[model samples]
Target: MSVFDTACGQVRGSGPDRGVVAVLGIPYAEPPFGADRFRAPRPRSPWAGIRDCADFGPVPPQSAQLPGAPSWSPGDEDVLSLNVWTPAAADGAAPGGPLPVLVWIHGGAYTFGSGAQPDFDGAALARAGLVVVTLNYRLGFEGFGHVPADGADPCPPNRGLLDQIAALTWVRRNIAAFGGAPGNVTVAGQSSGAASVACLMAMDSARGLFRRAIAHSAVGPCYSPELAGHLMEKVAAEAAVPATSAGLAAASPQTLVKASDAVVDAYRQNPHSGRHHWDPVLYGPVADGVHLRADPLAVLAGGAASGIDLLVCHTTQEYWLLDAVGSSAKVTTEEHLNRFAADFGLPDSLTQGYRGLMPEAPVGDVHLALYGDLMFGEYSSRLADAHARAGGRTFLSRFARQRGGSEPVAYAWHCADVPFAFGNLGEESIRFLIGGAPTAADHHLSARMTAAWVGFAATGEPGWEPLGASGGPVRTWDAADTTRAPAPGHWSDSGTVRTLWRSFGYRPLRP
Candidate 1:
């Protein structure tokens, strides 16, 4: 183990590289439980002696819905911690010469997921000459639920986001000892994590925390205050507790989690009823006009994210990973696609536009393609456009690599590109997602993806021209032949989908 001094205390980390070290489970904030429940995070108190930073810290209590999802459980409320990977020793100074930093935020629809998961190991990325850090934040009702707490201590909304800010603050003060330049940090994530990155950009509190940002398949970030209040009421009712911070603090985390799950389950069963204008997974950061005053996309369009270099990616078939929603087989006819579109107040003409784009694709495949756009593609494109229009440099790409045993799912479903980018495709948590065994081509593609990400983090140029507000340009990764060396191709956003996305209201989800 290698020992280093941080703001909080002395920490000893272990790593394989003689020159690389990893410090796991260092708290950035006091545990958000007991007296601290439902409150914004507070900085961790300093420790006296060398702290054993060997095993990962406890992750927040989470509810798992997928069969093979990574376990960040057996955990507790003392989970507002972070892990760091850096070179073992410095080149000149005690901490070492400054290195680029990559801070990853894990995604689980704002309710689940932890930074401690095996899928988020940063050793490989650390080996790529960067200080890699992953951190845990509050999730589900404890992190976000905004109840009316009349005559009680205030329960602030977006406690999870405040937790993230606290972690970043910890990094800024101490990462130099881990060989990272605070001014050169890049915040990145996938799915809801990506949405967090976007929301952070809009938050004035998050200003100057990081220099660059990368978001992968980011969904909507904020819920209407009415919706957030509604969900909190359901949770409060289910848990038989008053809708206030003092009442929730009296309840156990497991009880809150179960109550939250029941609320979402009911919404999923009948999503179209009443004010369920969005999907059940709509619980996230709320537009309380405080932490987040408005829609994040509108904020970005208004130049809230300006001056930060941005890179955003969306997989070709992101929605196909939704096994619960049935596969391409469910949508057999064009009429089916039209009916689905109508549910979201979209026009039947959108399906025709998609059909014209990929005429040879099967009808069900076309449906998957359309759903992909609705779920991830359209939002990502709008984010890119808004950032560019605000004069911020932006880069856009699509991951379309094929796999060996992916017959069950379509091309590059959600998160299929994560392991590749992190150069951890062999991780067991995502083995089922990776399909068959990793291939030589997979490794090669991974190398390129990592190189691009690292390059972006270091120099703010990802080996591509910055995409502007119009004339959309994209870099695509596809391996048509597994035996041959794969190369990324460039193309204009010539597809009609670009126009379609522009025409749509940029809503979170649709029919």
Candidate 2:
């Protein structure tokens, strides 16, 4: 066993090799239970002697949203812990070192997923010569549910975000013991986690915590105070309690979870009439003028992230995976497609534009394309555009390749690149997404992609040019081919999407 001292206390970790050393489940903050519940994250108290940190900690109580989404489990609220994977070396290396740190935040629409999941094991990236850290934060009602402070101890609105910031703060204080340079940190995540990264870049508290960021498929929006208040009341009603921290805090995690599920059920049953018609319940960061000062994308456009290098990417068929999770409806009739378009305040004529873009695709696939662009792809592209326009160094990528597919019309499904980026395609969580066994081509693509990510974390360059340069090239990655091209418009190559997003007040990502 190897032992290292951190600011909080000494921790015993597993033996190390030149390849990797792991120290798992070290608490970064105090348990958020009892009196601590519904409050901002507090520093974890120091321990005496060496504490064994070899096992993963319990994840936060999660609400069941989809089949694989995390759910309530029997555990205390001591979920704010982190796991670290670093290149093995002797103790007392230096005040600063050659290694760069990448802190990973997992995504589950901000409701499910844990940093300790097998899909996110950091050994591969650690073996490639970087320090990797993954952490868990409170989810659902315990994390983002806002109770009216109303002069009482204002229950912190963004406890989950506060937990993440606490973890990063821990890294900055103690990474040197693991041979990592606290000065060269990179924050990276996908989906909701990516949105968290975007939010962090705009946060004053997160300044100087990391020098670079990588956002993959970040589809997040700033929650307004009015929306958060309404959701809180809905959750409280389901729990049969008052809409305040003291009232809701007395409820068990399971009770809170059931309350959360009820709110979602109501939304799923009658979305337009649901209390939260525009926002997802008990998820996302709020623009409460406290933790987050403003809309994340607008802040980036205003140069809040100009000093931070950015690398953002997305899959070609992002919503295809949403279909895998039963999140999309099959468009069987022309009227169905028109209604779907109308829901976005878009012209029914936009359906023809989608069909024109993917002439060979079936109507259902086309519908998936439209939904994907609206929910995720467009946001990611526009974030890159905003960052680049603000003079931030930005590199955009399109993960357009996958295994086990013969037909090739944007087959790179959502969450597909994750395994490739981590160089762990054989993990069970990724098996369903990749279909059958992975091919030699898949392994090759994984290698190149992993190398690029590692390289980018080490330096600000990810083997691609900055966006909006000389034709605005976007580096496209596939198993058999990797090339660059002028911004490819939308994933579906539909002009309708561009116009629709513009109507929604988004500037174009493509030149």
True-structure RMSD, every candidate: 3.9, 3.7
**Model 1, span 10-50: residue lDDT tens:** 89887646566888999999999877888889989999999
Query: How far in Å is the alpha carbon of 155 misplaced in model 1?
Result: 1.7
Deviation (Å) of 164 in candidate 1: 0.7
How does model 2 score by TM-score? 0.91
- Model 2, residue 282: distance off in Å is 4.2
lDDT of 1: 0.77
Model 2, global lDDT: 0.78
Q: Any runs in candidate 2 off by more than 4 Å, and if so which? A: 64-72, 94-96, 271-282, 347-352, 406-411, 469-471, 486-500, 506-511
Give a tens-digit lDDT track for model 2, residues 30-135: 9998888888889999999998988878789875533332444766667888999877752458334558889999888777788877768888898887889999
Stretches > 4 Å off in candidate 1? 65-75, 91-96, 244-246, 271-278, 324-339, 355-364, 404-410, 480-494, 507-511
Best by TM-score: 2
